[model samples]
Target: MNFIESELLRIFVGEQEKLHHRPLYELLVSEALERGMAGATVFRGLLSFGLRHKVHTSKIFELAGELPMVIEIVDITEKIEEFLPVVEALLRDSGAQSLVTREAVRQWTT
Candidate 1:
C-alpha cells in the first residue's frame, strides 16, 4: 500500500470548449503526453457551474451539450511548474475559462 509522492494539477473547463475544432480535453491530454507527463485524466461532471454562475447538466431536458469537464495531470513538482505556463498559454489562446489547482498526491502503480 505504499505510495509515491507527486503533484496533482487539475483544470476545470466546459465540455463544449474547443480549439481548432478539437475538444479541449483531448488537446490537453495529447499535450500532456507529448510533454512526457506521468499521467492525465479527464472527467465529465453531471451538473456544475463556473464563474458565470450558470448551471450545466446532462439531464434529458437540457438544451445544450456544454457540461462541466475537468482535466487532471500528475507528476513531479518541477514538471508541474514547468507545464503550468504552457497550459495557461493554451487557455489564453483558446479563450477558454478554466480553474487550475495544485496539490500533493500519493500515487500507486501496479
Candidate 2:
C-alpha cells in the first residue's frame, strides 16, 4: 500500500460550445499549477454523455469527441481552496453546470 498526502477536487461538466470545451478546464488547471499545486489532471472520457442526453459516444475515430470531461486536481487543501473563486468564475463563464466534490486526504498515491 502506498500513502501520500493530497487534496482532491473534482469538476464535473457537461457539453457546451466548442470554445468552452478545454479552455475552461485549462484555465482552472493553469491557475492551480501557477499556485504550485502538486499536480492537476484533465480526463476526457472515452464514452460519456451529459445533461444534453445526446449520447456523445461514437463508433469511429470521433469516439472521444463532444464527450463530457471530468477535470480533477490535487494539491494541498489550502491551495485548492485559494483557487476556488477563479474556478467558480470559470464555471460561470462557461455556463457549465457542474458538480464540485471535495474530501479530506487520507492516502492518495499512484
Number of the top candidate by lDDT? 1
Q: What is the lDDT, from 0 to 100, of the residue 98 in candidate 2?
A: 80
Runs of candidate 1 exceeding 4 Å displacement: 60-63
Instruction: Report the Cα lDDT for candidate 2.
Output: 0.71
Instruction: Please give, for residues 1-110, the per-residue lDDT of candidate 2 as tens digits.
Output: 67666678988764342234465667777877887877778876667655666666645555555666678888777877887887887788777668788876745566
TM values, all candidates: 0.89, 0.71
lDDT of 1 by residue, 1-110 (tens): 66778999999988888999999888988999999999999999888777777888788456357787889999988889989988998898789988889999978865
RMSD of 1: 1.7
| Model 2 bad stretches (over 4 Å) | 1-5, 14-22, 60-64, 106-110
Clashing residue pairs, backbone N/CA/C < 3 A, model 1 = none
Clashes of each: 0, 0
Q: For model 1, where is the 10-residue window of minimal lDDT?
A: 57-66
Q: Pick the candidate with the highest TM-score.
A: 1
**Model 2 poorest ten-residue lDDT run:** 14-23
After best superposition, candidate 2 residue 110: deviation in angstroms? 13
